[model samples]
Target chain A: MCKKPLIDLHDDKLFITFEGELTLYTIANIEKALAYVKTYSFNALQLDFQDVTFLDTAGALFIYNLEKYFTKKEIAVTLLLEDTTQKDTLNLIKENMKSSHKSVPRKQKSFLEQTGELFYNYYIGLLSFLHFFGKLFTTNLRYITSLKNIRFKEIAFEINESAIRALGIIALTSFLIGLVVAYQSAYQLKIYGANIFIVDMLGISIFRELAPLITAIVIAGRSGSAYAAQIGAMKITQELDAMKTMGFEPFAFLVLPRIIALVITMPILIFVADMMAMLGGLIVANIDLNITMELFMDRFSEVIAAKHFYVGIVKGPFFAFLIAAIGIYRGLKVKDDTQSIGFNTTKSVVESIFAVIVCDAVFSIAFTNLGI
Target chain B: MEFIKVRDVRTVLGDKIVHDGLNLTINEGEIYGLLGPSGCGKTTLLREMVLLQEFTSGSIELLGKRLETISERDAQSLRHQWGVLFQFGALFSSLTLKENVALPLIEYTELSEKMIDEIVRFKINLVGLKTEDANLYPSEISGGMRKKAGLARALAMDPKLLFLDEPTSGLDPISAREFDSLILKLRDMLGLTIVMVSHDLQSIYDTLDKVAIIDNKKIIYEGTLQEVTNVKNDFIESFFGKMK
Candidate 1:
């Protein structure tokens, strides 16, 4: 099934029907659905798997995590399994939880220690998606409110000084990126006797990957470092503490604004980078493959699907979110002195770039499998 | 009324004991000095008062309420009642002096721009900075000026209690004395209860109504400067001995 039938119940009963291949990709959606279900006022959840056609380790783990979560909430989970494989998977999860629960000595651990361990594990397990979502929403709220209060002139100055200074470098990087993608794709296209198709290849590649990735990297270096150093230095100096002492949440005032500014500006920058890189590819394609601009445009239209645009746009905010988060996180984590300011700034840029790449990879895999 | 009370406060960082069974009280409008040499846990005690540093044991009561028992929001609310001048005047370099001073006022109040600007200018001028200096960034200012600017930012909220750590450490002798005067003036003018950590003997004598001396991980002396000076102990004597 392309979409799972959502179960709505007044009581604690959760009924879910999944159809299609149950891989890690599909399993994540199911897990999200379960989490959404949990947020409702419910005491018991009964999951129905009557329409689910496939089962895998990924799907099993998804169910297991949900089960563990529900067990902690003291909510009973009843698995309605029609298939033997599904039953076996449920049994495996139940047995695993039982064994692990038994392993921890209840008497040896203090209540706080056990609670701390539980919370830490819960946090780590939900970190990738849940944490990002929380950060994104809360950070957006924080930034919006901070932006409203601050002098608009200061924000303009920051944007002009910090973001505008890096615009040229971003353009240069995106231009070179387009040229590289065109140059690389041209060789393979030439071997296939479709040398003119290099335009199509570069257009799609840049729109779908290189432009967004390059722009994100540029931002990671430029804006991310700026954000880190600004806040990191604030933290180093005790301005962050001063803000708190004055009854202002640092995350709301400091991190929130930068995160908001980055998220708002990054996608626009990516769009700009996309257009410029596409032009770069056009120039290279005309010189290397002798394709006219008109022909190149026609070929790009024919070959570049809407899915490419969807994928590119989808990753923009994700990259923006990641860079802003890593920058702010490293900044806030800074302890003592000017040395940590410099160190965390470097770490923010490096980690932001690495996170952008990894996120791009995951999105690629997810989109490719989803046929988006 | 005593604005802040610390009872049997102890702090351990890993295997190291930072503070052991320390107790103190600061009345309203008193400039209480925590005088100690380096590594005597003065800063640690200061951090505990702000709730930035957790204590291993004991209770910190600010405004007659226990700190650890308060909710996070309440703790934050209580913390907001004080302005802190960290050792370095940790002004947000990204913000101009005006903006740095305006931070607390902006965060806690819904005052109009004219109002905020007025308050910012008032605090800046209170610390003896020119209004032209308000447009300059913290880095653009001198070290002593930065410290004054930090104090201005702290005072922007019109705090009831003020915490200052080494407000005079790196300043010239003149600037240090001036800062001490500012502290005395603030305490007098605003009736601010001040908690400060300093090794500067001149500042101690200039501002503090009472002093708490930390030696060997615990408070060895808790009294006025004259009381601490009269103590025949070598460390206390020698600590004040350099003044003459």
Candidate 2:
């Protein structure tokens, strides 16, 4: 039942009475009445609880706080609890409040202890990641040996969703990047009458770095977030729980398709990216330097060797594996709240981007050592 | 004084007219039930009262203040004067039960942390939940417990009027009866004026002092439960005659 808890000023004393539940449900009404009472001057305030059918800790705390407030303002507040149960409940809550407050300090961890806890959690996180990697590696090896058991349709759909759908964005961004690079370089190269060298720069940069890095970054943002969010939702809704109970492996059904799809498609997406980038460079070369498409192609083929293209494509599957693994890991980390899905998704994106860059750096070192 | 006065209320949602020329009055300290079949706009009426839903044409008053024509600040201030228990406990999943109850106090009041903690502990307990439940998130608790926690959240502001949207639908029979008695006790003790949307015949009969039933987007019957039962009509016959 909802009734406004009210207060009346009578005989220089304010009398507060609750006509409804004093719980959080009706707290606003009680607060409204208190706000009204606070405006007027009174010698004392009294609370009448004879009509109060229910009295709990919340109601008791309200009275106690009201009492403390009035006392601070040089006004005396009295509580009238005619019901024995109401009085007992109030007293019990008052006692428990003190005890609960006291328990806080005893339970609170020390500064060093809290620091140790932070480190301990990170340690556990690293171990969990290693364990996840081991399980995924073993599962993939097992599934690969029995390749006939894999779901090709699901893999095709994943490729369509994660990789094929991403081609548009990748093409657009890479073309623009190539155009920007060629335009910026043409001006500097033209100053030294070395405009023809722009082809060599575009070819090396786009093939050996830009195409692979841009494609990986784009896919990480697109498909990585989706994988994390999808799995996270499944986790929160307990669909993953249901799958586990039914003896369905989430790794094989969910993770495997996504990974297989990304692995197969990443290189194709990179190859497309390379074509778009070179086309953008070729257009800029023709427009800015008066170089014909034939001349541009001839110079590009001479300047950019096949090894540069090979270096970019070679990094695709590794980048794909890293992105998929990070997304799947973050998704699994999502706990009870929908908030965790958001948090994990963002973390997955950031982590995958970092991992991709780190992988690219390693590739750069290895390729340089081999003189590719 | 008339606590709630609705005049010439008209509402149309999407392609359907939910209510037309609807009028109702709710007096102070009277437990009123809005009863109807599913999709009859029982909950819609409650939402309109709380200003969550807007009507096409109507003048609605709460605590002698016009609801439709109020300043945004005044409207927000007015929200503090009443409580709403949603069909499901819409407790913030990120916040624990205690934090959920304390949210309003923290938002609206300048009470000390100690006071809020005490109140949070007390409200959850009043609803028959233990102190341990305070640390538990909504998902961690049972459906019935979540309902109670929702009620606790609604009560956090100590609203005069409690708006309930089928408070007993998902509970077990015993729990439903317990919830009913809890409402009755709150009514008797605090003199609460309750407006609830309910399909449960037992809840309507047990807890409501007055009732209004809607059918075909109109109030088919408006009276005490006994009076409605006495009125012989096809819908009434089909409605109450079968509940027994």
Clashes of 1: 2
The model with the greatest lDDT is 2
> For model 2, what is the C-alpha lDDT against the true structure?
0.84
Tens digit per residue, CA lDDT, model 2, A40-62: 98898787777777766777787
- Which candidate leads the pack in TM-score? 1
> Which CAPRI level is candidate 1?
acceptable
DockQ each: 0.42, 0.01
The residue ranges of model 1 lying beyond 4 angstroms of the native Cα positions read: A1-165, B229-234, B241-244
User: What DockQ class does candidate 2 belong to?
Assistant: incorrect
Q: What root-mean-square deviation over C-alphas does model 2 reach?
A: 24.7
Q: What TM value does chain B of candidate 2 have? A: 0.96
lDDT of 1 by residue, A135-245 (tens): 657646545565465535545655665566768888888888888778777777878889877866776788788888988988888888878887777776777776666
User: What 10-residue stretch in candidate 1 chain A is worst by lDDT?
Assistant: A146-155
